[model samples]
Target: MSFRDRTHAGRELALRLVERAGSGHLIDVLVLALPPGGVPVAAEVAGALHAPLDVLVAGEISTPVRPETAIGALVADDPPLYDRRSLAMMHLSEDRLGDVVVGERNELHRREYLYRGRRPLPSVNGRTVVLVDDGLTTGLTATAALRFLRRHGPTRLVLAIPVGNARTLSSLRDECDALVCLQQPPSLHAVGEWYEDFAPVSDTQVADTLHAFHATA
Candidate 1:
């Protein structure tokens, strides 16, 4: 199925998620978005539920030889951890692991500053935290985000994405408390291919969205 845009996809996904979420007397049910692509979709979800929204910054560690290939990702303010088996399967060198981690951490820091300002990360302790992203492809970014959030002691972690590859969704099932995803195409090409309006979300838009949320809060 094709989406008109990310907002359309998010609303549809949110409807499905709300049904599964059930009637709850809950606390700190924050929606954490992975910027800058996830921010737009996450905003719609947050508005739909009247829940607080925040950003979780992470950066993909690209393969040195094939720059487009994401070996893994590093979550902001979190210790570097990698899937040793995946690295071995990819035939990545142990010597390059440090460089990859350092480079990804630096990029993650840059993204953190770009997407978030002085505002502190929302406390998810004993709270149901819904993590939203536009789409999941390789799952590196989502995995990193989950690892970081686990440290924050959330009661539950619900990962919501508009669309995802089947393999990627399956990989995340064990990592998250709940998974809310719409379409899972057999031959997943790219996340942009599923949406009609697949424009890149800008950092300025992310900051503006956060500022608007803060003003209203």
Candidate 2:
């Protein structure tokens, strides 16, 4: 399945979550989006579930050699979550990525502060937390977000995306209580390929989205 854009994919994803909500699968729901891409998609979901929306800033760590590849990820003030296998294959160690991690972490904090301002991350404890992203590739960023949310004592943790690779999605089952994806194709080269209008989301867009949500909320 393909989408017109993140908003379109989000609408489709929202329908399924609405079904789950109707069946009593979701309760005391709280939607946390991985900005800035996840913000638009998650707005649809928070609307459908009538839940409060928030942002969970996570960053991907990669080397200059192959910056497209995510060797690890991080969320908030937590330690970096690295893929040991990937590190071994790349012949690199955590120490080797220190500068990269520092840069990513700094950017992550900047986005978090921009999107949230003085507001602390909403209490996920005892709430059904739905972690939303536009799509999953290697799933490194989502995995990091999920692990951080898990440690926060959420009653039930869920990871939701519009599209992803079937194999990668299956491997992330243990990260959350429920995993929702609209399409899991045999092979997904990249997330943008599935979207007709895969535009770059800016920091201003992210802040505006959060501001709009908070205005009425």
Candidate 3:
């Protein structure tokens, strides 16, 4: 199944989530999206559940030579999550990735500040947090974010995505309390392949989405 766009995917995904929660009441649920792609999808979920929307700043640490290839990901105030399998295949070690970690860390903090203004981060203690992403690919970023949030002691953690690679979902679903994925394609291709309008989400778009959701919530 192909989604029209992130918003359309968001609406469809929200319906499943609402049904899962029963009666559409999610008072303890906090919706956190991994920006900038996750923001648009998350806006719809936040609207549906009447939950506060926020950004969880995490970044992919691209490989040294092939910048498009992610070797790992870094979440806020946490050590970079290196893909052991990828690192072994590349014959790379954590020591050789100092520069990549530094760069992604800088970017991660920048996005955190840019997405969130003066408002303090919402307390996650004892809350059922639903982390949203537009799509799941390598799963490194989502894993890192989940690990990072673990320190905050959330009552339960859920990973929600519009579409994902089937292989990745199998592994990730077990990591979170629950996983809400609309599609897990068997043929395993790029996340964008599942969407008809998989356009790049801009910084302004991320900010606007959060602003719009927060205004209503």
Candidate 4:
């Protein structure tokens, strides 16, 4: 079924996730969204679980030749950066690794400034963190987010999304403690294809959603 919008997708995905989670016991659990697409969906998930919502700043490094193809990803303030092997396995070019890194870093900085302002990042140490997104296609951003979460010492890391491609889902299975996705289409096109309304989420929308969720919590 095609989602009416990101908000509709979020509600549906959150219901499925809550069912899969098998309980509504997310007492201290945190929902970390990979913006700017992930924010709306993550807000719904956080609301459903009655959990605190946080933002995980990251960006995808798309291949120069194939802009739709993700070369790699970069997570802000994370150590033990992803290696070339990871990129190569994804069919990314090692020759353009430097360029990819530089571009991704610049985007990451802009995203961080736009979404975070002067607010400090939340602590995920020894807590159950539900990393959320609107959908997963290449899984590059999800991988980077998982790696960053690991470094921050989350007791359990769950990667959650509304929709995902089969290959991307398969690749991410072993990366996180658990994977919760609503749809996994075999012949995936783009992340926006499955939804009826897949508008590009803005930084202001993300901030407003975060604040609204926090206020209600």
Rank the candidate models, highest lDDT first: 2, 3, 1, 4
lDDT of 1 by residue, 114-179 (tens): 667666787888898999999988887898899789888999899999889998789889888888
Worst 10 residues of 1 by lDDT: 19-28
Q: How does candidate 2 fare on TM-score? A: 0.97
Candidate 3 per-residue C-alpha lDDT over 122-155 given as tens digits, one digit per residue, 9 for 90 to 100: 8899998999999988898999888888789998
- Alpha-carbon lDDT, every model: 0.81, 0.92, 0.86, 0.80
Which of the two candidates, 1 or 4, achieves a greater lDDT against the reference? 1
Candidate 2's C-alpha runs over 4 A off are none
Model 1 stretches astray by more than 4 angstroms: 25-27, 81-86
**Candidate 3 ranges beyond 4 A from true positions:** 23-27
How many pairs collide in each candidate, listed in order?
Answer: 0, 0, 0, 0
Better of 3 and 4 by lDDT: 3
Please give the lDDT score at residue 126 for candidate 4. 84
Best by TM-score: 2
Q: Which predicted model would earn the best lDDT?
A: 2
Expressed as tens digits, the lDDT of each residue in 1-217 for candidate 2 is: 6899999998999999999999998999999999888999999999989999999999989888888788899999899989899999999999988988899889988888888998999999999999999998888889889989999899999899999889999999998999999999979988999999999999898888888889999
Clashing pairs in 2: none
Per-prediction TM-score to the true structure, in the order listed: 0.91, 0.97, 0.94, 0.86
**Model 3 TM-score (2 dp):** 0.94
